[model samples]
Target: MQTRRRFKQTKTLSDRLADEAARCRAEARTLTPGRRREMLLRQARQDETAMQIEAWLRSPGLRAPT
Candidate 1:
């Protein structure tokens, strides 16, 4: 019997962008609102795409200031 191989799913664009932001934070690099908004808007301007951005923001480390 032959078995099929299973591969992990590729990371979504939102996941990748969030990782970029986190890496920038870790490196003490500034993520200005203009840049962030641009990144988010680029992703959020679609049907379910907005949800990914929302999910990213709601992630434990990505919250906005209260």
Candidate 2:
């Protein structure tokens, strides 16, 4: 019997937030106008979170290694 190992790459927080935002937007497209509003809001929040993560990454505090 041979064992196979699967290699998985870890996703960064920004990447995950971006992916979630995309998924929320895609789902919103399939929803009714009334329901879509909530999804759109969720997508916006995800996008905002991603932007915050990116901003944090660029901050001077994070630039230097501890």
Candidate 3:
């Protein structure tokens, strides 16, 4: 069987997500208003929202749902 290549991630998920959102925003700023720019901005929003949800999940006061 062929094994998949595995690599270790150096940055935490939150950090990685933040970096991605920032990169997307920067790229979007450089593009003219259009579908591609809109898509990039949407991705950036998603990354930011994910980061928020992750933080909320990790909060100390949260409990598992029934």
Q: Model 3 — TM-score against the truth?
A: 0.89
What TM-score would each prediction reach against the true structure? 0.31, 0.54, 0.89
Misplaced by over 4 Å in model 1 are 1-9, 29-66
Q: For candidate 3, write residues 13-58 as lDDT tens digits.
A: 9999999999999999999999999999999999999999999999
Give per-model CA RMSD.
11.6, 5.4, 1.2
TM-score of structure candidate 2: 0.54
Worst 10 residues of 2 by lDDT: 35-44
Each candidate structure's count of clashing pairs: 0, 0, 0
Per-residue accuracy of model 1 over 1-66 as CA lDDT, tens digit each = 999999886997567666655554544334456766565544434524555767877789875779
TM-score, cand. 1: 0.31
Candidate number of the best lDDT: 3
lDDT of 1 at 42: 49
- lDDT winner between candidates 1 and 3: 3
Q: What C-alpha root-mean-square deviation, in Å, does candidate 2 show against the real structure?
A: 5.4
lDDT of each: 0.59, 0.77, 0.98
